[model samples]
Target: MNSTLWIVRVVLAVVFLASGTAMLTLSRARMIARLGAWIEAVPIGAVRLLGALEVLAAIGLVVPPLVGIAPMLAAAAASGVFLVMVGAIVLHAREREYLQVVMNLALAAMAVFATWGQLAS
Candidate 1:
């Protein structure tokens, strides 16, 4: 169980970090090209805010636990990731992007399991 949790944590950390970096560094046009037309609908500031949150959560998910400092923060970060996935699911559903909805659901499930496992441990 511990091994599984660690693996999930590392994978999710990478996922969030990469995505957050892209959002923070990319131009609006680039983001729209990469993400979809939906990117054009959202304000750039909102996207950046989401990116900032993701990056913070990614760090929270890994750093505290690894450093043996306030490890419970990992669970909290997973919870935040779950919320983000929920929002992603909703947005994808609204856009009729069923594939993305499925992807987000899987990510959300991973977040839930990570949160539960970390908190339980």
Candidate 2:
């Protein structure tokens, strides 16, 4: 169970980190080309905010627990990831991007399970 949770956390962290970094670094046109119309649906400020949160959450998911201090932060970060994915699902659904919604759902489920397993442990 612990191993499973670690695996999930690492995967989530890697994904979020890459996504957040892209959002932070990419221009609107670049993002639009890569991510489709959903980038235009939200304000640039909101995108930056979400990107910041994701990057922080990614770091939070790994650092505290790995360093053996404030391990509860790992669970908290997992929960944060779940919430972020929930928002992603909402945005993707609103944009009629069903495929993105499904992907978000899977990631959200993994985030939830990771949080649950960590909290239980």
Candidate 3:
């Protein structure tokens, strides 16, 4: 179980780090513009803030664990991802993007489980 949790943590850390970096840097304005169409009700600044938070969480997921000082930071970061996934599901649902909602929910579940496993251990 420990090994499995470690693997899950590493995979999720890598994925979120890459994704968050992309969100922060890769055509960020364009990506925010795309999201704007679906969530016109939301402020673009808020979305950008969320992107920044994701990047911070991604760093949190890897740094502390790797450094051996505060493994709980990794779990906390996983929790942040879980929260982001919840927001994603809600946004997708509002946009009637049912498939995306499902996918985000699944990812949220995995994050939650991994977070709990890490924290518990």
lDDT of each: 0.90, 0.90, 0.75
lDDT of 3 by residue, 1-121 (tens): 8777777777776766665665566454666454434435556566557768877877776788778988898898889899999888888888888987887887788788878987887
Query: For residues 1-121, what per-residue lDDT tens digits would candidate 2 score against the true structure?
Result: 7788888889999999988887899998988887678999889999888889989999999898889899999899999999989888998998999999999999999999989987898
Best-to-worst ranking by TM-score: 1, 2, 3
Q: How does model 1 score by TM-score? A: 0.96
RMSD of each: 0.9, 0.9, 2.6
Ranking by lDDT: 2, 1, 3
TM-score of each: 0.96, 0.96, 0.80
**Candidate 1 segments exceeding 4 Å error:** none
Residues 71-94, model 1: lDDT tens digits = 999999999999999998888788
Q: Lowest summed lDDT over 10 consecutive residues: which window, candidate 3?
A: 32-41
- Regarding lDDT, does 2 or 3 come out ahead? 2
Which segments of model 2 are wrong by more than 4 Å?
none
**Model 2: per-residue Cα lDDT at residue 65:** 82
